[model samples]
Target: MAKKKAVGQRGSWFATVDGIELPCAHRRWAKKNWPHYHDPFKPTENGPSASKILKYVQAIKDEKQVILTNDDEHLDDEGELTGFTRLNYIAIYGVENVSFDPDAGLKFTITKRLVELR
Candidate 1:
């Protein structure tokens, strides 16, 4: 059985399908719900895999520019491009928690603070 989230679990539940990410609800009050995305790697744990995290860490170590983009296809309210736009950023201070649903084959999100080169 899948482990349920903490008390009053209310958050975004996502899954990946053919490289496309799909979203749904999570932690029903009565039932155990989970995404149905088939994990090709068949990971033993629920997350983005070690290789994914290493990529970013390596970039930070090498002081390489990290590309930033919005997941949405529309322009964000903050003026950030919703689509792909080349934003070269250097000096990543640190990275936040990175996790995902293994059963759903979800694409994990990486949160990091970047120092933009002026």
Candidate 2:
């Protein structure tokens, strides 16, 4: 059975999905929400999986160019069509705090910060 309470402040609930405890806004929202799915491995809990659909993003900061990559697929917003075979680094960002819906496979978003090299 699902539990409901009006006490406390708004956005407060514990998720009990498949015997796994996850905190969320609505407790009942996870009930049979994801039909057949498994939680991804967290960086802290487990190392980044190589099979993930994530790539790298290259950028320069303070004359020191660096390549950063995360465990999530990302899009390039920059309008520069730089050569892909150049000797430059890359960067990557991930969509955080993603929630799953039974019918919906996976849903998440990513926000990137850009700094031009002058």
Candidate 3:
């Protein structure tokens, strides 16, 4: 028989986004693929990005609901939030899709799998 991993021990970090909770690893995966976005010397800078993303998500959860897909518009054409910032957002808030409204603010679509049922 194979040994089973302890609950919460083997899984990646998770955060709540739009009432749904998801693993942070997914965002980390995206960031890992984009090496240039990260500061090689100061890796810890990426840590706070997650919290920022969560704050963004939490503020809009009631109106935006859930995150569904990834889009290029999530970041600026110059690539703000495209690398580590984007990764942190995805990991902490489950915001798969992002858009900006000049009059409003950042708009997002989130994952549904881990939604918290009322």
Candidate 4:
């Protein structure tokens, strides 16, 4: 029998937009909750495409700033980080590039420009 593939064995993809290391999995919650902003990727299915993600990044970058926070902060009354809630606002920067690794998944790099921490 063929050896079974491990979970996330194929790894993931990451994109660095406006100096933020945005992992492909980072916006999972947004993908499900806010389809307008987040578009999930599933290489195995007809899911998000690279250009689509790039567009999203560009849109966010155009904002010139954004608020970011830990996914845990979106927990529901049941103490589960499921559903939508106010996202912690974090400073924004510039994009560098997006990378992929078969073992490590996706990796992103941010711009070298300095961004004030709020």
Best by TM-score: 4
Regions more than 4 Å wrong, model 3: 1-44, 49-51, 71-118
The residue pairs that clash in candidate 2, if any, are: 33-102, 57-90, 57-91, 58-89, 58-90, 58-91, 68-92
Clashes of each: 0, 7, 7, 12
Residue by residue across 1-118, what tens digits does model 1's lDDT show?
A: 2221211112222222234232321111102222221212334344444666444344433432222221222355986333322222222223222234434332322244333222
How many clashing pairs does model 2 include? Answer: 7
Alpha carbon lDDT of each predicted model: 0.29, 0.25, 0.35, 0.37
Model 4 lDDT tens row, 34-77: 32223223253444566755654554444432333223334548
Residue 30, model 4: Cα distance from true site in angstroms: 16
Candidate 3 lDDT by residue in tens digits, 28-61: 2234544212122122343345455455445444
Per-model TM-score, in order, reads: 0.23, 0.19, 0.20, 0.30
What's the CA RMSD of model 1 in angstroms?
A: 17.6
Clashes of 1: 0
lDDT measured at residue 111 in model 2 versus the true structure, 0 to 100? 33
Pick the winner on TM-score between candidates 1 and 4: 4
- In TM-score terms, candidate 4 sits at 0.30
Error of 3 at 101 (Å): 28
